[model samples]
Each structure stands twice: as C-alpha cells, then as structure tokens.
Target: MAKTNLKTATAKQRIFRKAINLLNQIFFTWNNGNEEELVSFLQTIRDKSPNVQFQKLIASSVPFLNAFVQNQNSNLFSRIYRHPFIQGYSLPYEVGNTKLVHSDWLRSVLIRAVCYCSSVEDFNLERIYLELTCLTNGYSLRFVETHVQHFFNFFHLHPMRYSRDQIMYNKFRHNWFNYIKIQHELSDQLQQFDDKGQLIHLNYLYEYGAR
Candidate 1:
C-alpha cells in the first residue's frame, strides 16, 4: 500500500514537472528558442494564398488573439500584491492612480473584460485601449489613432501585402510583442506545424531546453 502511494505521488510530480517545463519553454523566447518563432508570426500574417481576404483573416483571429491577451492579463494580475498594505511598483492599481483615478481603472477594465476568461487571450490590451480611448497614457486622440490605424491602412492601401509606409517601425511597435505571444499561443492551438514552421510532433525535442 505504501509503495502504491509512493508511485502515485511520483506520477503526479512528473505531470506537474512537465507542465512547468512546457510553460517555461513557451514563455522563455529570449535564448531558449531561435528567431524563428518571432518571424513565424509575421509569416502567418503575410504568408497567404491569393484568395485570402486580409480583413476576414484579421477578423477571424481577433477573438482568439483577444482571449490570449486576457489570459496573460489574468496571470499578471494574479501575481500582484492586492493587499491594501502594499504600495509596490508591480501593483495594477498604480497604472490608474499614476494616471489619476478613484481606483485602478486599467485593472477594472481588465477585470471586467477578463475575470471570467478560462483560457489565454490577446497579447496587447494597451494597443486595443488606444483605439477605445482618447485620453491618458501620454496619448492624444491623433496619436492613439495612428497606432491602430496603420493595421487598417496596411490592408486598405495594399491588398496583396503590407507596405513599408503602412506599418512603419515606430508606428506598430506593440505588434512585435503581440506576435511573439501569438506565436506561443499558436503552438498550443495545433498538433501540426509550430509558429516557427517546425513540426511539433516530429520535433518533440525535450533535449534543447532545461528539463
């Protein structure tokens, strides 16, 4: 009976270890993986057949992307010191009090939008908020519009591909991190090719990262 209990405990530990290891591999992109994950996001957006409508593709992915963002926000929110005694930098309340508010406006919005979310959401809520708001965060109405408008202009101007003018380096900076996170989420979404174009089933290399 004791041996059976020990074996059960060992099996549970193995599953927990795999979950932690997988999460670490997915989140740690700095040195663990190559630049392929980064470029793969761009490839997903840009690499398409002629029949694909750009707007349709973008529209379809919005919910999945938004879900991914909310999941991350929930994770971040859970990590913070919510106690009234703590006044640290990592507090979500800081975002609003620093901006001028009764409570954490950003946190409130995040809670309202994402508290019930069960899965990962979008990557960049800040960029999304840019379109929804005309105030705060060192942004003017015009400035906020520019950040989001480029995505539309990218497709509006060029039906086939993204133009340099449409998505300038400084214009869509939020997209870089967004795509990186999207690449991670994409990996979990399928059993086929990964964001880096690598076959996941074929390349179950538990050898590269720290296990």
Candidate 2:
C-alpha cells in the first residue's frame, strides 16, 4: 500500500481558508448581539465594504435576527442557526380558537415569509422548520392556529400567481399576516409558553394536515 498525501495542505487551500477568515471578520461579526457594537461596525464598513448585497441581506434580515438573538441562548455563530431574521414571523393572535385561520390570505403570507427568511441565511433546515412551526408572538395558541390556516389559504389561492422567491406581502385589506419569516432557525430551540408563563406544546399548529 502506498502512502497517500490526500490530507496534505496546499497553497490554494490556505488561500481559501484565509479568505473565509477575512469574510467572516468583515461580514459575519455584525451578527454578534451587541447592538451598539454592530451599529458602530456597520458605520465603519459603510463606505469600503465587500458585496453590497450582503449589506442588503443583513439590513432586510436584521429585525428577525435581533429577535432571535435577544430570545435565544448562544454565541454569534451558534445563534445564526435560529437567527429569527431567517425564520420569518407571524401575526399576533389568540390561541385555541379556530376562527383566525379563516383568513386564508394571511396564512399564505406567513408561509411565504417563513420560506423567504429561511432562504436568506445558511442554517440547518430542520431547525428552521421546527421553529417556524412552534414560534409566535406570545399571543394565543388558538389564534396562532387560525393565523396558520389563514396563511395556508393565501398560499393556496395564489398558487402560481406568486414566485417561490417572493415574500407573501399583503395589501388592500387582505389577510392581515404582515410580518415575514426569518432566513434561519434559532439555536436555543423554541419553547412554547402560555400567558400564565406555563410551558405548553402545540406541534399541531403548523402541521398543514388534511385542510
């Protein structure tokens, strides 16, 4: 058997490694939760920057990203997994009541929003799926269910009218599901809590079952 040098490092490999290091230092450091630090860093990079699209991507995803970082427990790299900026958002509604799902238009918006956010960041897809299913604004579970139903309806009705890459934004008094989902899932994992601060579980909410 001959000894193989497959594991040996090369100049190109080193170059790529250094490039990634520089990219992270320049682009991903802002993902750190210190808002003030991030703002200051953004100001510094405002003029001479790399990939302006990255800026746009970060700008668009910031709100959800901030929410995930604020709520979750993890460092910058780990938090990117469930970066709320990449997981999308839902309408604030009550839980347990089925009436809210009636607005099909809104439900679809939520679905599209979640999809859009997930597409923006490089994160674990399974985590994103689970979080989007379980995440909400601390409103009612039943109301959230209704919102999901409404979101599905919107997606179904539109069918081919909208592009898969487009966010399901609403207007003209359609379904009220406005906020979009983020591009990544959170690392802390999603915990369901009721108004009384009791732990609860509602996996069935986003399951798109025989509807």
Each prediction's Cα lDDT score? 0.33, 0.35
TM-scores of the candidates are 0.21, 0.21
Model 2 scores a C-alpha lDDT of 0.35
Q: Best candidate, TM-score-wise?
A: 2
The numbered model that scores best in lDDT is 2
What's model 1's overall lDDT? 0.33
What residue runs in model 2 are displaced by over 4 Å at the alpha carbon? Answer: 1-138, 157-211
Stretches of candidate 1 off by over 4 Å are 1-24, 27-128, 132-134, 157-211
Over 31-70, each residue of candidate 1 has an lDDT whose tens digit, in order, gives 1234574344324434442222222222111222222221
Question: Residues 34-136, candidate 2, lDDT per residue (tens digit)?
Answer: 6675465445444343333234234322323322222133322122323435545544345654334534434454443443333323222432443355444
